[model samples]
Target: MKKKIYNILSVCLFALLVSACYDDEGNYDYHEISTINTEGLEKSYTKTSYQDVLHLEPTVTATGGESDFEYLWTLNLTKGSGTTSNKIEIILDTIGTDRVLDFPVNIKQGFYDLTFRVTNKSNKLETYQVMSLSVVTKFSEGFYLLKDMGNSTDVDLHASDNSLVDNIFLKMDGEHMPDAPVSLGLDPGYCFVDETTAEYVITKALTVCTEKDVRISNIEDMSTIYTHSNMFLGGEAPEEKPYYVWRNAYGVGYISDKGAYFSTQASLWDLLGTGKFGFPAMVNDDEETKPNRNGVFASTCFYYLDELKGRFLFLDYNGSLHTYSDLDENNEEKPNKPNGITHHLKFFGKNYMDKKSTGYALFEDENTAGKHYIYQLVLGMDPFNPIEKVTEVATSSKLNGANLFAVNELTAKVMYFVNDNQLYMYDLVQNTEELLRPTDMATGEEITYISNRYWSGSDNADKNFDYLVFATRKDGKYKVYLYEILGGKPYGKPVRVLEGEGKVVKMHYVDPSMSMVSYSYFPNSF
Candidate 1:
């Protein structure tokens, strides 16, 4: 009887093993998908900007396949002479027979062909479909001015065609910004997008609104591109204060009460945090982490000030952020770098002279023995290792209380800074300062803001007719003055006078060659 029981147990164990093998075999079926078809599919789409998502949902039908199958959707962007593959892939999790594929597409203005691949238990099949997408914006070629009109802010566009459109935001969308406009960040019209095209953008701040508090618009028609209306308004205002905004080569990067945040040209106000939207943080885990992206301003020559870290950061071409100390380890100048902890860092946006150069300048604050000395950083060296060049240019306590600073290639190595209504010229080469008092203008009207071709194209490559535009306020009115600098001084009386512009708080000149030379101002109270 015991031998009989052993024989039965052995037979039962063998049967169990065979059953497991059969189930495993079933996982690999010999099914094949046949006659896959897509219905009600659109072959072409119109996309306004990179932020606009093109929704494509097509009904799919397949026959002669397993009851359920996996789906994959892919879009291959055409690069080079339409030979290279710029692929974006998405996989569907759920298995299905007859289904609809929901795909959202965001890419630069170009053409792309999409494909869908289906996989069954044992067989794989792919279907190819070609489609065309067109993207165009009115802000592509123009000079844009974002104005604050107490109740609501508006935008003005001076198109390349010499046509001026006033309050274009309202004309395009029938809406104004959230509140009174505080600050505006405009690209100096650099073609960071491609060799032939540039996407001009405008970033502005509002007074009263919180959610969707910041607005970024396209310069083509002053149409709204992206708004940080709901998502980012909860954090502390990043501008350190309202009416102040920070910008880089292509996007608006500012320190919010929350943290450092930035958005790109293609993606207006996504408000990407560090390492989130491919933004190269000054410090990251690895240098080879992210890909070089074309979303920001100048990939090679953009610098930003991190007030929280008390350090100046440079964004390299390959989506990496580095400081002067982080550039080269063996450099002798690395040791003399300022201790961000011991000394305070005061950064002036757009204060440096050359916007297109590899280096910029700033004031290093030192506190000792109840006396303070302001050191001017005339960084003329490259960020990466090469030859040892001059970095720190000048230092003086007399250059304090400077509210406005600007640099340009036309002025050669000279820099201009405004302190308490007095305009002082600091020669970065000679290491000297000259105070020039205006002869005829408004008394007690100190220079509130100053702008020039510093932020113009190619670091002042087109400096032949470059002029310095300054703003002053007196008797509740704002006046803009333009002076041509010859022999390192204001050559003549204000060549251009734009009087009666109410409360001219900020000013910038688009390269005259790029757009018709026009300036727009906002009223004190609208």
Candidate 2:
């Protein structure tokens, strides 16, 4: 018992001695914490674009503990209140790690918060600044407004959102747009082959023509795929720019001072085309028939004479200097009448009422140059002479002095034309002229251009609506009016009147759905 008590007391004494040695009243010293500051950062940035360089150089300052610092810059997409997954932040990327951030803005268009953080390495103290950043792309979707400004061209884009992106040619090409506009043609899609790799991609292609040049480009970004000389299979451009360029599902071809060149033949084995236009189609590749040049610039171009698919008959009214050729789907010529007397025709289009083989061309007799005779063709499957019968159009003074003609593509049910500042619609079936406006003539107000296009709305895959549009110039200013067609006459109120710069040469609506590789794919050689 005595030994146990001694052992326990000894253990307690050793524990107490150790605790007393460790416990001490000591004077402690404290060091100051490090701090960081960013003073030169802007509160927000606006008008930024894709492929733009986002320059961020904030003045940073750090004090106390070693003064060593680390930098970071991060981008996060700014989502709105009702956006999906409200709790999660979309961290786009860590754009930078240095004090000065010279980041190339490669992210798609969106509102974002750009953050810069500086950390004091010695004390682990951090400071950050967030700036509002917005990225925009004008090329996303829009109507390319090709305007004639006399000395130079202004290819502006009226965005689908109603925002105007002016002078897109200068903004994109870094050069002034060329002037003396020849033609601006649009195909559903074009396949461009890489000049070096021989690889190809189908894209939204647009043909632009000036007095000096003819070029094809991807309409989405206005990026050039082929220039003048490179557009032909011979590797030589036309000495004269094409006065008119035309394309359809059947072929892509152009008429220049030289002659006609076709880029595609629907019957050819290579439906994709050779990526360049070939020489004019020939009869057994022997005799060449250039388009009949009736007037300067071939004022009266060719038309599909019958309900036939690919046979274009260039009208020759004055003489038999030109002969009609029956081109098969292979674009090869066929025997005419088995007698060799090719028919010569002068075709005036009521080229409206589309979607079917409704061939409506007003045949111009040799004597009646200014008269209108509407002819709707009903013919055999192999129409040797498509014109079975003709309807003599009743004469009217309203048609007098009427110069411009616009056939509505709603299948030409009604055509719109202006006479002496007055707008009129001629019913092809009724064989009558109805004046849409009376006392419409006012001094200093003149109608400039008129046409029709198939348009439904933005992002519209099915172009269902047909609108008859016309432009008027008053007091040195121009405005275009759009009217929807219901039952052949312009229905209801004017859909919209667009005011633009200079003279509106053409308006091409950009469909976002056209950007896909296979969407509306056609054999447009480039």
lDDT of 2: 0.55
Clash numbers, per candidate: 14, 5
**Consecutive 10-residue window with the lowest summed lDDT within model 2:** 517-526
Alpha-carbon RMSD, each predicted model:
17.5, 12.9
lDDT tens readout by residue for model 1, 1-526: 9999999999999999999888443466565537666666677665555456555566655676444556665555433211122222222222222345544333433334455455553356646455554443434434445555456766554554556566666776677655665555543221122113432222222212222265544343343444443224343333322322234434434333333334453222222221112222446643321211101123223444444554555554333456555345455554334224244334332222344332334444455332322333333235543212333433453455566665534445666778767887776557678886554556678566665533343233544345666777666555666677675566668765665433444444333222111111111110
Which segments of candidate 2 are over 4 A away from where they belong? 1-137, 170-179, 196-198, 257-259, 265-274, 292-355, 362-369, 378-383, 391-397, 438-444, 456-464, 515-526
What local distance difference test score does each model get?
0.44, 0.55
lDDT by residue for model 2 over 316-412, one digit each (tens)? 2111122232444455554322112233334344342333333454434446565555555421133243442456656654554465556554445
